[model samples]
Target: MTVTEELVRKRAEHNEGEICSLEELALHQQDIEKIEFLNKNCKKLRILYLQNNLISRIENINRLKELEYLNLALNNIEIIENLEGCESLKKLELTVNFIGDLTSVENLVNLGTLEELYLIGNPCTDYTGYREYVIATLPQLKVLDGEEIGKSERITAFQNLSKHYKTILKSQEDYFYKRVCRFLSVNVQALEKVQAQQRRETFSKKLEENNGDIEKIAKEFWQEKGPYTPESRTETYEFLRLQKEQESQKAASFEETKPRRKIFFAEDGRPYNINEPKIEFKFYEEIMENEQYFVLDIAAYKNMDTSLIDCDVQTNYVRVTLRNKVFQMALPEEVHPDKSSVQRSRVTGRLLVRMPKVKSSSIIEPQNTKWKRTTGSVEKTESKDKMKGGKSNFLTVGETTASVDWRNITNAEDSRSGDLEMQKRAPVHRRKERENSPSFVDNPDVPPLE
Candidate 1:
């Protein structure tokens, strides 16, 4: 993949929406095949690390004049060049690369500030007189391949540079032939097929969502990528950039179009209740012993963080916010917000709110139910007809009788026996004159004479 402006800005540690303010940047192991955008944007960078990549050329970094350290180890770089603009460079690391050109070491002569140079594990390191040629050519280098160049070694390398010159030249020729054969043996078509496979795997999820429509996916992939040319890589990166921007714009549009809920007050100057989250809840008054409370239980989202939930309990209403969505309702009775307590169940994730009632109330009966009266007496009418052939037992009209017989008004079969039983249980000195009369056989209150 080629380095893009977005990638550079993201890798800038001190970047606060601007890349020029950055001093250090590390872009290692990102599979970057080409170097781009750093020279044009981050001109103030001091230290740069672009190691462990697929980069084959060193380019587009000549503008980093403030750069002091550069690390380009373990890449496909064959020759180190295009760093004449880094006047303040002190150390350079190019370890374990394919640098076969020993003559390219002379390029660092322009960077007079370079002190340490590392080229260990490179193709040029195995050449005859490689260390001597590097030390003699770059006089400013204090350390080479992790070893400090002593005064004696530097003097000896400069003296013998003439003798090893012909052998170094022969080795360079051999390496050139080897590099050509290596490139010739590689199958370009096979490498391209592998790259295409990787691209397919990258978009495999999109393919599955499209029901495995290869033709549609191919058309979409090559939408802006024009005919096969050297700039096809640049075209692919541009397409990705546009796709990301479009996604961001779509998200912003969705947020702008979402419906917003109004709480607190209605448009007509009345209190309003909103349940934007549509949470199911139960609000009721509970009477327990001497205490009464207004209980509200809401079925909030399960396993949600408590930090995302907010609650406010008022005298006659309640408001709960879940992840910014408001859920509010008016209470059936006034409550005390200060004395209210709220708890969340760990098992069911239910929010339970209990508010002390402002005015305690008892259980009220239904308005439509009727009740029997407990006060006042009931009067009854007395019969006027007299018993046949018997003296009047009931009192006559306007006559003030001293006593009246209650057995005459009772049922005939139960009067005598029932009254006798009651008279036996009654207090002593009660009247027995009626019992002494001679109408015992005819009296209906009397039991059978047999």
Candidate 2:
């Protein structure tokens, strides 16, 4: 039966006060859909019996400040809430109801004067050590589920609770570590594929929600996941966005700290020399008048003396050594080994080499030649005289020419017959003119005129 004014009047008559001043109200099993009328006329009421009713909420009781005893047993209530203002409450009965977890007990902890609490026949009671947990949580309770609590029981319950929580935390940590390792071990390509598929699905869902408006979807996607305000949308969305950002940051940090492996690619014919200390040097080449010149900048070896520098030059290769470093390079073309020159600059620490071009008629021969000790010497080979059948004599000033037949000048007849015949005739005329003249030619080997 629903609670009516006649029922309220009948219940008030059994109490020790008038209808308006009644301190106790037993309206159990009355199918009360609401408690609005109770707070309007029952201002002085302290004890409220709301058991076995259709009430699904524990609200609208805040105006009953002096309320001490509240019986909400055997109701359809799904959550325990909105009882914060019942400051004078000492006993609360919530037995045989739909409360599912001990999380609801947290709200009741604010009841400072509460000493008795009953939660029997609730689903939360099915959990192991639920009674101990409740007692440890609500230390002010003298009786829990009709059982009296003692000091020793409270201490034992607290110890068990601490151990249980520590075990849970450790298990969670281990599970998380294992999951991280597994995630890292998965192939990156596969993971990226999965992520792409998930993004596609999310995009499809959003497109449907926005009536396939691509522009609207794009705008929504690019919008800042948020600087959340009190008026922002669902808390779950905010939480997920923050979680995604944190995960991205963690991934970026991991990549930053991760070590990179060094890779070297070797050419088909060129193998890296492990024994050689890696040093970079500059190379230059020039060609001039049948010669090739090369200069190597070995400035890194500036600290070494000239004597410590070593070089080997060949017809088609060169090898240099300085301190602990060695460099070997193959010449691009064949060169004349006998005419090649190698020198090092003391002031600039540069290595200069000249390799003459090999003549077409000559064969290049390999020679294991080392650099000469002299710093600036150029090696060259002199060519022999080319004229055949011609004997040339060196003549000094005031020396007489040797007598010879002018007709025997076969090669000179074609090129210089007139000039030679004039020379032959002029010498005779010079002798006669000299003899007739008074002044004589003065010579150390000749007798002076008397």
- Measured by TM-score, the strongest candidate is 1
Off by over 4 Å in 1: 185-289, 292-352, 355-450
Residue 176 miss distance in model 1 (angstroms) = 2.5
Clashing pairs in 1: none
Clash totals in order: 0, 0
Tens digits of per-residue lDDT, candidate 2, 367-418, equal 3332222234432222225323564343333434576666675565466877
All models: lDDT? Answer: 0.79, 0.65
- Cα misplacement distance, residue 281 of candidate 2 (Å): 99
TM-score versus the correct structure, for each prediction: 0.48, 0.35
For residue 51, give model 1's deviation from the true position in Å. 1.5
Q: Using lDDT as the measure, which candidate wins?
A: 1
> Which residue segments of model 2 deviate by more than 4 Å?
1-7, 15-19, 162-450
